[model samples]
Target: MHKVIIKYVLIGVLAATALTSPVRAEAVVPLTVQQFFEVCQPTRVTDFVDDNDYIQFGLCMGVIVGLSSLMDLNCQLDRNDTPNHLKADLSGGNTSLTAYRQTMWNYSNDNPSLRSFPVGMLAASLAEEWPCIEPL
Candidate 1:
């Protein structure tokens, strides 16, 4: 009976050590917007086959508008960079375009409520504006 108890204790200890051992950390590679676009291209192509040109143009315009708004809002929210470091960088132009792309992608994926209404409005507005452009 004592031997059986000792065997179980040893097994538990081994199991605990194995479970707690540090995992090999994954290599972190920072992705660029182009790479992200490429990863998402197939889905975009399939989804917007008919409105590809309009969709692309709208995305570009939306990003520009969103970033401008973010800057304006940040300036009002944080006069000094001390409290909101990321907001300060975003407002100051230290954050790259890739950051904005990543943010949009994250918002679209993580929060449908944040996505749907704005996207619908943007699409409608862009589609209305599309025909006014003279072919280059």
Candidate 2:
């Protein structure tokens, strides 16, 4: 009696869930590696800052570096410098995160294939833009 009722209720619940699950399954569109990069790439300078004008480039760089690092994409930084460390070095009275973001954005446009690991491209760009000068 009671057992029979509970068994039917469970079956009904299972059937209902099975019918609804396909809707969620269909909503998730799978993205390829290139597509993922295209979607994640920075579009504008404001993407790296807020109303306060404080640097948010670290966060954007973190997501780019973090995902690539986890994927083992070989996006190593020069001397293994972290994003915050790099941003700190780049920061100055005139230079801003916006400039850094724009530089990265331009690099991304010129070389779309490197999107999987942009930090490598960024390191190269930084090296070009500001070569080290040793004092004699």
Candidate 3:
């Protein structure tokens, strides 16, 4: 089944832009690769009183869903201001939250760096898929 996936055209996947500076400063690492990893790969606790893996997983996915909705809204405004782009496939087909979640899940497993930056790693995960190429 085809669904809408976030296709990120990270113009500056690594560089902090005018938009990300204030966000990075105000954020106590609101979204980071480390947090994603923790949420996606939470430790199983037998202690019923302390079990919160499901909660964290829900919250993490919720954020991504919210972001996806916002991206969709922005598209209506015809303003692709952010590095985020939405599509179905590598060529922008049917977008799905599972696709983005899976991409983040798979990407974090390999590069286990605790970079507490604003969605920089998120952009990186989709960079190879939707790169902002310049004609030579």
Candidate 4:
């Protein structure tokens, strides 16, 4: 009975550790400049024209840009720079829109003056005018 109990306890401990272990998964689609523009354009415009949506949209875009930049740097996806482990902390981390938004909120908090209205308008304009020459 003692040996059986010990085996069960060991099994439980191992199972718990396995469950808690972090897993890293590759990004589903590499974020392209074209996709970035496509996602940002409408959101920016809607925020600009509508006072109600401006703040939310602006903050959202800021976060998206921020995350993309970070991912690009970490993954060495940028054309100019060599890839590095700048995002070592985020290793085995989950990637999703909610995570991006949270990161944006943190960024906004650090820079309080970066309000939604202006940022949103600017992002909208950039998205609208900029042509993504890069092939996805």
Best-performing candidate as measured by TM-score: 3
Q: Best to worst by lDDT, what's the order?
A: 3, 2, 1, 4
Model 4 agreement with the true structure over 1-136: per-residue lDDT tens digits? 9999999999999988765544212111214333233233333353354433444455445646665455444443334353232232232346554444444344334444444333322222222222122235
| lDDT of each candidate versus the true structure | 0.41, 0.44, 0.51, 0.41
Local lDDT at 24 for model 3: 39
Better by TM-score, candidate 4 or 1: 1
Better by lDDT, candidate 3 or 2 = 3
* Per-prediction TM-score to the true structure, in the order listed: 0.32, 0.37, 0.45, 0.27
Candidate 1 TM-score, C-alpha based:
0.32
Considering every candidate listed, which one attains the maximal lDDT? 3
lDDT of 2 by residue, 89-115 (tens): 232236544455455556566777776
Q: Tens digit of lDDT per residue, candidate 1, span 36-121?
A: 23332223334554444444535554554564455446545545542332232334346554444445455445444443243322
RMSD of each: 16.9, 10.8, 17.4, 16.0
List model 3 lDDT by residue over 1-136, tens digit each. Answer: 1232222324444454744655334323227777776555433334324324444555666766654555444444444454444321232457566676677667777776644655545645554454433224
The weakest ten consecutive residues by lDDT in model 1 span 126-135
Clashing pairs in 1: none
Q: Is candidate 3 or candidate 4 better by lDDT?
A: 3
